[model samples]
Target: MWACKNEGEDARLYQAVKACSEFAISLGINIPTGKDSLSMKQKYKDGEVIAPGTVIISAAGHCDDITAVVEPVLRKSGGAIYYINLSGDRYKLGGSSFAQILNKVGTETPDILDAGQFKTTFNTLQELIKAGKVQAGHDIGSGGLITTLLELCFADRNLGASLDLSALGDQDIIETLFAENIGIVFQADASAEAILKANGVVYHQIGTVNETAQLTVKNASGNWSFDIDHLRDVWFKTSYLLDEKQSGPVKAKERFDNYKNHVLNYSFPLNFDGKKPVIDAAKPRPKAAVLREKGSNSERELANAMYLAGFDVKDVHMTDLISGRETLEDIQFIGAVGGFSNSDVLGSAKGWAGAFLYNEKAKQALTNFFKREDTLSVGVCNGCQLFVELGLINEDHEEKPKMLHNDSAKHESIFTSLTIQENNSVMLSTLAGSTLGVWVSHGEGKFHLPYAEDQYHIVSKYAYETYPANPNGSDYNTAMISDQTGRHLVMMPHIERSLFQWHWANYPEGRKDEVSPWMEAFVNAREWIEKLAK
Candidate 1:
């Protein structure tokens, strides 16, 4: 959001917001909430200057597991690479970051074609992710294809890639590499070529992931090569402090080797091998409540998932419970839906949790509800943060083991992979040792459990204890944990987001029609509730 005093600029801002809303609607997505400030000006000794009018769009949606998400990094030498053209128009360099850096602005803004084209491209890409056809993925933006490729190469310091822009047709090297266009670049096996072709997706196979320490791009004119280490040093400008050996060839190579051998080779897969029994929704089901707060955004999807899993679901709000409009007495299970309740005031979920703590009636109701032996509860994302705040996860409400800022020091939204523990909590008991891809987006998500030596049952952990895989840098790479009784589960990842196979970024091949493994958690809760009720 930006402020502008001029009416003309405000009109333009409204037009831009309208365009963005239409674009989102075209793609079947929604913009739930937004913020705006109308006046922004600075007065100096000479005069007052009105700030540039701008409309910032925050696009957020649920995605399948982060485990299967395509990172910008190149992985597996020899993997085929592709360039997907999303903009059905000519390449233009106007307003590009590259042009701005060079102090040159062009006359033409790159044309964004019909929304239908992007919709098709995105759908195809989603299928590819679900099928595990894409190993790495990146959108073409910023410095255009060139910078995107560089980011990929730098994503994993040990990896490099080689490509030929000749497949992009008779475009100039500058236009081909620097044009800020709507497109995507991804890496996959050769089999993906047939998949794209069969789906009528417009794409060009342009390169391969390689072991060489360089970014090699070839055009009709000739071949160009950039030394990986030098590029990193120049681009990062502080490699001396971050990776001190960037200037040394032998030391860099040694470090790359260690990263490849130790980190790159680590692998874990889904456990069932396509043999797990389908959830029998026809069987007797238990009643459940999907709790929500004023700012709770995930209740609909979670309630839908529960209903689909054969639970008689009710959408309950905090006001409903406190005002005697709703009761949990009839509910055998509860899903604490995730969201930025009360705009994450006082910290993540703190305001939402305070409702339970400060309201005597609601507090007594929840206490009596929790005492029921036949009940089980699951909290996700913001709900998980609330659980920690309310001492649901930690019975004694220890000062440690609190939800804190992610080590990355910023909000992170990405698909991440996690490994289910062998002796995981009850919600994930059937998925022990399985690797899952789940989406996670949060600012203060890190689980700071300083005393987590063996107190809580850890359900899932990051496959790789790194930036995005272990997004929040939780203690022991913990993604999900449970209370001592195993009846209460709190997890940071959005498992409910992947209840449907189509919602996944990648699902096992031939399992496209099946529901995701995440549904198991809900079904398990239902089963537990039924048995305890008996």
Candidate 2:
């Protein structure tokens, strides 16, 4: 594992880094690789901009087989959901996103009761997973149980869950249900109860997955049943509603109500034309280029996923191409990883796109790379934004699509659901018709497609019965798209994040023993690359 920290020069930043180092030391963690960009200040003629001192910590780890990993998706209806406590009687809402939503800021900082207890809890959970005891798991954070529990339910559209908070000894219902605390919730098989008890972990039987399509919680006040669909719309409301007008377009309650029953399947024919792949005995793997720019962050994980998918991975930096330090001459696959390149100025990835457009060397190299029929490209999040802006994603159209500010006024981060579409891009060909859970944390993610719908292939769409399942309120709930040729694909979600099961703090019970579906994206890309290589 490797850790990197970037801190703006300030007393707070210095102290925070010290505390972080102490925590890392306690965990026996080492910072082997890292980068730092200091002095985040800009001065204009009249006024100067001094941004808040901040520290961004990035970490990466080596996993033998991502296919053995789990994902946070609510599984079989009738599965048991357990909430495991790690903070020992501490459920603080200080600095919580939920508090900000309610226009309330509390002074108490959320704390870990004991680092030892946390380590024990985490290790025990891993033990259960290793023993095939845990079906799925998710750690509680941010908006608290309300967010966590709902996310579990949303993992599968077919689930309706019921929770009885009565087991949670006398406490303020609001605080108990909405406090941001250190804890994890997971589903397990009935037989795992023995192991859970032997482990001596603090836990509670909070809920049961059902088919009612409702979220029922029994509290001291009484039994409360919320229409799951309506709750979803409110849970994912586009904006912090000062009123209805800013709420944007919310799907009808009926849509949410029947979403669980809606069978979403597409039968569009695939149009891939290529000769059979011939893997040379001497060189079995094709070279895959994982591209990154200054602010690019997801490169490590994206590259990791591709490497796991059987590619000869190459780290490609935009600066290298622009300075003629490196070339994509032999690369078969090109991936633009996500990040706030150029600090998302003039819109997300706009600055990154400008570099490709203005730098003659970089531009020509990329053009030549894309012109190769065997070469394929995929862009994610900020990378997706840049591809659309540069006409890589929708070259077939005169007026291409654009990623715009989400109807949500601010950045919304969550593990959301999406379903693959038929006749999609080569990268998703094998994932068609499958539903998945992927992380989406972006402010400017909504898609503005000006061309006719048929001009491009829709790779996937949000499983939104209401507001947030659609996340960004994109047109047609579109989450990803490809160029007319299907070789170039771009998407908003972090598919690489779901490469392993543990990547999900809470995973689907039914899929607990299975690998994440997102791996198919890379698998499909590899297969495509191999075919073109022939």
Best by TM-score: 1
* lDDT per residue as tens, model 1, 5-50: 5657777887888888888898888888888887787789999787
RMSD of 1: 8.4
Which of the numbered candidates is closest to the native, going by highest lDDT? 1
Over 1-534, each residue of candidate 2 has an lDDT whose tens digit, in order, gives 112132434556667768777777766677676556555667799986666555566778766545445456566743588887677756677777868888977877576666666776777777777766666677888778877887776645556778988777667777777888778888877766676678676778888888766788887777777676666667644433432344333423433344344433322224321122333558688789998888888999999888877788999889889998777998888899888898887788889998899999899899999888888899999889988888887676778788898875556577767788886588787768767667888888998987666766888988764455565778778999888788888999999887666665444433433346566667788877667657
The whole-model C-alpha lDDT of candidate 2 against the native structure comes to: 0.73
Tell me the RMSD of model 2 versus the true structure: 10.1
